[model samples]
Every structure is written in C-alpha cells, then in structure tokens.
Target: MSDASAVTVAVLDDLRQESEELDLLVAGADAARWAGPTPAEGWTVAHQIAHLHWTDRVALIAVTEPDAFAAEVEKALAHPGTFVDEAAGELVALLPPGELLTRWREGRDRLRAALGAAPPGVKFPWYGPPMSVASMATARLMETWAHGQDVADALGVTRTPTARLRHVARIGVRARGYAYLVRGMQAPEEEFRVELDTPDGGTVAFGPEDAPQRVTGPLLDFCLLVTQRAHRDDLAVRAVGPDADRWLDIAQAFAGPAGPGRAPKRGAAGRGDAE
Candidate 1:
C-alpha cells in the first residue's frame, strides 16, 4: 500500500479499536453510573460521550460541507471563549444516556464513512487549521482515547493500555510547537527528542536522534500529559532542558484553549493518573 493508504488504515483501525473498548466499558452501566462524575471537573460520563458525539458531527460537517462548516466556525469564533463549553453542556443535558450512546455511535459511523470517501490529499477545515483526511482521522482517534479515559476513571475501572497509544504519543510530539504557540510563547528553536516505552514492550522515538532537549517516559504517562487528562506532577515523564520542561508543563496535542487540566491528586490511591 501507498504511505497515505497505510496511514488511513492505521488511523481507522485505532479509532475503531478505541471506540470498541469504550463501548464494552459502558455497556452494562446503569443510568446512575452514566451520571457519575469524571476526572474532568463537573463533567459526567454522559458529558464525555456527548462531547465525542458532537465533535464527530462537527468533523462530518468539515468533510462533507465546507461552506457550512466555515459558517459554523465563524459562529464559534464570534462567541469566542464560552461557546464550546456551553454547547457541550446543553447537548449532554438534553440527551439521556442510552440516546447519547446511540447518537455517538451513529455519528462516528458517519464520520468514518465520510473519511473513507474523501478524495486523496483533500484537506478538511477544522476549528483550527485544515487537516488532511489521515490527520483528521488520527485526531478523532486521539480524542476518543482521551475521553474514554475520562469515562473509565468515572466508573473506577482499569483500562489495559494498548499499542494504539503510539498514535497519541506521536501527535503529542508533533504538537510541541503548537503547544507553545497557543500559549503565546515562542517555541524553542532546538529540536527535542521524545522517547516512550510502550505497553507492548516496545519503544517509540520521535525527533532527531541527537537533539539537546528530550522527553523520556512511559507511553501512558506521555499520552496523559499531552491530552491534559492528568497533572504533570502526577505523571512519571522526565524532561531535560528548559524547553522540554516547559513543553511538558503545557503540552497539548488537541486544539483549543490551554485547558485547566486535572489537579494533582496527591493522596488519591490506586487510580490510573499516576501510572
């Protein structure tokens, strides 16, 4: 297969796998469990699923209706800071757990179909810059895994880390500059190396081999840090050099605001945050 085709296949596989794992996790939960609080402050399991569904719809619009998607982006920009959060809350409040799950599943299926049909090398507009179909698919996978973590934590369930995290880790490393740019800081000129130990007893490395700045850690810890799912103090990632240190503090693989990530849970025990 060509490189682009390979990327599309890998991203789709990861997306489907992540969704299936999350589906099994919430399959038997009652309504009360869906209403349980997640690590994201004030966001319940229902909210997590709603957010994913809403984004899936937005992505579908991006791929299929460029003008409409542009208009929606303009609307979001007009309201500025509060629109996304407000819209997400409204969505979750309107849907019951079963309905929310159905909506998410349907939207994701549509999104996958749309992505598959997209012409090769075509770019889809997003809340940020436009992304190629492969990058768009990978972004969806990253979001799915991150939100799934929230749902898993809300239910106090342990998730088996998978090799799919390699995609998230790669995104995290590539977004090094974007993270600094969003914070209005000048991204460092020096190249930084990221070394991660994956769950399958393999290592994934990014950036130049002899770069001065480096981040080294378990894949789970690196993924958690970049996704803003856990506090830096709660993760085991180690950074060398000033740029690497600052990047770890503000690492964001996803677009939008620098989130007020989860607070360090000093005494919380047996949770997945630290691992």
Candidate 2:
C-alpha cells in the first residue's frame, strides 16, 4: 500500500480499538444483562448492538452497491420521522443474544475491510450527504464511542476517556451549523471558537482564534454534549455568546434529524463527571 493508504489505515485503526472496547464490555455479559435497559429509553443492550450491526450492514451496502443504497435511501425518505427507530426495533427483535453478537462482529469486520479498500477520493452516499473515506471512518468511530457510552452507563462501568475523543470533538465543532440547519434555523454567520482540554493535558482547538463566540470545556464533556448523550445543563462546557449557547443546546456531531437529547438525569447525574 502507498504511504497515503498507510496513513488512512492508521486512522481506521481507531475503529478497531473502539470495537474491541465494546466487545470487552459485552463479551461476558449474561443474557439478563444483555436484555437489560440502557440509557436510551426503551432500548436494551441488545438493541444497541443490533442497531450498530444494522447500520454497519447498511453502510457496507452503500460502499459496495450504490444503486441498492439509493433505493434504501428512497425508502427512508418515504417515511420521514420514524424510520430509524422503527427499523432498529424491527432488527433488534429478530435476533437472539448470540446471533446479535455474531452479526455485529461479522458486519464490523466487513465494514472495516470495505472501507480500507475504497479509493481515497471517492465519496460514499449517506443519509444526509456524501462522505469521503476519512470522514466515514471518523463518523464510524464517533458512533461506536457514543453508543458504547450508553452501554457502559447501563452496565455501571466507567470508561477511561482517551485521545481518540479528538476525532469526535472535531466533528462536534464542525457540526455547529448543522445543528442549527437541522432545526430549520439559519446558522449564524460569525464563526465560533472551540477549545477543549484533552485527557493527556494537551489541547485541541477549532474555529477562528478571534471569533466573538466561543466554547471552552473538557473534551469528554464536549463529545457527550455534541452526541446528545448528556444534557447541556449537565456539562462544564461554557459558551461565550448567544449563538454559541444555542449551539451547545442542540449540538449534533452525527447526521440525521435533530436528536431528542437525553432527558436530564434527576439527581447527582446532573452534576457528576461527564466521562
């Protein structure tokens, strides 16, 4: 492989690490735990894994069969608001615990292989827009990390925050306007700066240095905020201006309709460490 391919493959390595982390979380769980409820309302641990597996399968089709992927997109468009949830429920109910785990692992392997072989500059069609190879990998990593957080929460396990969160943070910073756009509001013209303190005591900065609007916080909290896994009120994230504050309220790093963010956890959850 070329040096460029090597670099891209290294970026994809994060996906493998994330998958392994999740595997370790679920690998030894008994059936009762697998069927237990997660932070996502009405979704059990099995449902989370099933959704990941199904999305991975659909993403593979997008990479390998463009026409078939377009047809699926059309089906999604036909039923606007409820498609994603309905689809997840249907797929989750179809599998036993062992089958679900096997399907998820198989789909993840196939997705990694297909993405590794895709041409460097080709864009894959997706629900919102096309994504370049690197963007796709980053998106996949973000999904794995976000969903994994839910599983970890349900299992009462604490996950170590890592530098890999930079990718998700970057996506969050970039999606500031997307958050507004999806909600049918025009994104503000002024750029907003984002500065995050990394787990290793380093910093990752985005946007203009001189912008009047800014957000500053721990990187893990920023990731959770953007993923809608934590309420804005629960995070240490500070916004300097009105627009920045609005973005924090509705920030979404992932594609799709505006997510109904997690309801504020009633007690200590509102004040606890985000990661």
Candidate 3:
C-alpha cells in the first residue's frame, strides 16, 4: 500500500475500534439506562448515541453525495444552534433503545465503508470546512471518545486510557486556531509546543521545542479538556505563557460554535497549574 493509504487504514481502524468500544458500553443498555441523563445538559445517554448516528449519516452523505450534503449544510445554517439537538431528539423520539442501537451500528458501518473507499486527495465538505478522509475519520473518533466519556460518566464507569486517545489529542492540537477563530479571537502568531504524557509513560510532542508558548500534561487530560468533556480546572493540563493559557480555556476539538465547557467540579481548584 502507498504511504498515505497506509495512514488512512490505520486511522480508520482506530475509528472503528473507538466506535466499537462505545458500542460495548451501550449495546445491552435497558431503556431506563438509555434515558439516564448525561453531562451534556438536557441530553440523555440515548441522545448521545443518536447524535453520533445522525452525524455519521450526514458524514456519509458528505462523502458519497456532495450535492445532497449541501442541503444538509443549508439546514444546519438555517438553524445553527438547534439543528444538531433537534436531529438527535427526533431520533430518540422515533426509535426505541433497541432500534436506535441497531441504526447507530448500521450508520457507523456505512460511514466506515464510504470513508474507506474515498479517493486519495479527495476532500469532503463539512459544516466547518472540507476534510480529507483520514481527517474525517479522526474527527469521528474524537467525537466518539468525547461522547463516550459522557456515557461512561452517566453509567459510573471508568474507561482505561489508551493510545487511541492520541488521535483525539492530535485533533485537539490542530484545532487550536479554530478554537480561537470561533470565539472571534485571532490565534497567536507564534507556534506553541505541547508535550503530553502518554498512557504508556512516553511523550507525544507537537510544534517546535523552542516555541514561546507551551502546554504540558497527561494526554488523557489534554484530550478531555479539548473535547470539553472535563473542565480545565479539573484536569492536570498546565500552560505557560498567556496565549497558551488562553488556548486551554477556549480549546475545543469539535467543529461548531464555542461549546459551553463543563463547569469545574464542586470544590475543584482553579485552572490547571498554569504559569
């Protein structure tokens, strides 16, 4: 296989693994469990899965039917804030837990197939911007992991951190500028160095070593912070310099308006050990 193709396959495999992990969590859930409230205010466990199903279906359209995807974009533009929630709510109301689970599984399988078959160098249109197939897979994985966190939290489950988080962390790092842009702020001109302690006790570093701004912390904490799944204050992430500190406060890996990030846990200390 070509170098790029190999990379794509790896990402897609990771995406599948991430989705399957989440599936295992909810596959046997009873209706009461599916209706349990999650951290994403007003969204239940069922809503989280429905949202993933809705997004994957739309993403498949973007990959295989560009013109049709434009209509989806138009719908999003018309509603902006409520469109996502509305779709998820409709799915939840229309389908019972069992049907929802089956549909979500089918949608994910179709999306994986479509993305895998996409031509190299082709970019698929999205709500934010076009994305390459590999990037699309990574974004899906990040969302799955983030939403899965909510499910895990509701179910009182603790998932072991894994290397798959590297994909989510990478997206978190890459979306630094988008985080700023969405908030009507310009990103710092200078690159920032980020060093995350991986689950295996190694490090995954990004950007230049000599960069003036830096963020350092556990990879899982960084991923949680960027995905807005955990409040910065509750995470171990540390930032140096004003820009990096600001980035941590506003960082979001998902494409959308700035999310109302999770509130600091009751009695939790303030923003990580930033200097």
Model 1 TM-score (2 dp): 0.94
Residues 74-193, candidate 3: write the lDDT tens digits: 898899889999999999999999999999999999999999999999999998768999999999999999999999999999999989999999999999889988889999989999
Which segments of model 3 are wrong by more than 4 Å? 266-270
Best candidate, lDDT: 3
Each prediction's whole-model lDDT (CA)? 0.85, 0.86, 0.93
Report how far residue 241 has shifted in candidate 1, in Å. Answer: 0.8
Off by over 4 Å in 1: 267-275
lDDT ranking from best to worst? 3, 2, 1
Checking candidate 1 for backbone clashes, the offending pairs are none
- What candidate 2 gets wrong by more than 4 Å, as runs, is 1-7, 266-275
Pairs of residues clashing in candidate 2:
none
**What order do you get sorting by TM-score, best first?**
3, 1, 2
| TM-score against truth, every candidate | 0.94, 0.93, 0.98
Clash count for each candidate, listed in order shown: 0, 0, 0
Q: What are the per-residue Cα lDDT tens digits for candidate 1 across 1-275?
A: 78888889878878988988898888789999998899887788888888888899989999999888988788788887666667779888898888888888999999998998788989988876688888888899999999999999889889989988988988888788888887888998888888899888889999998988788889999999999998888777888887788788889989876777878866434222311
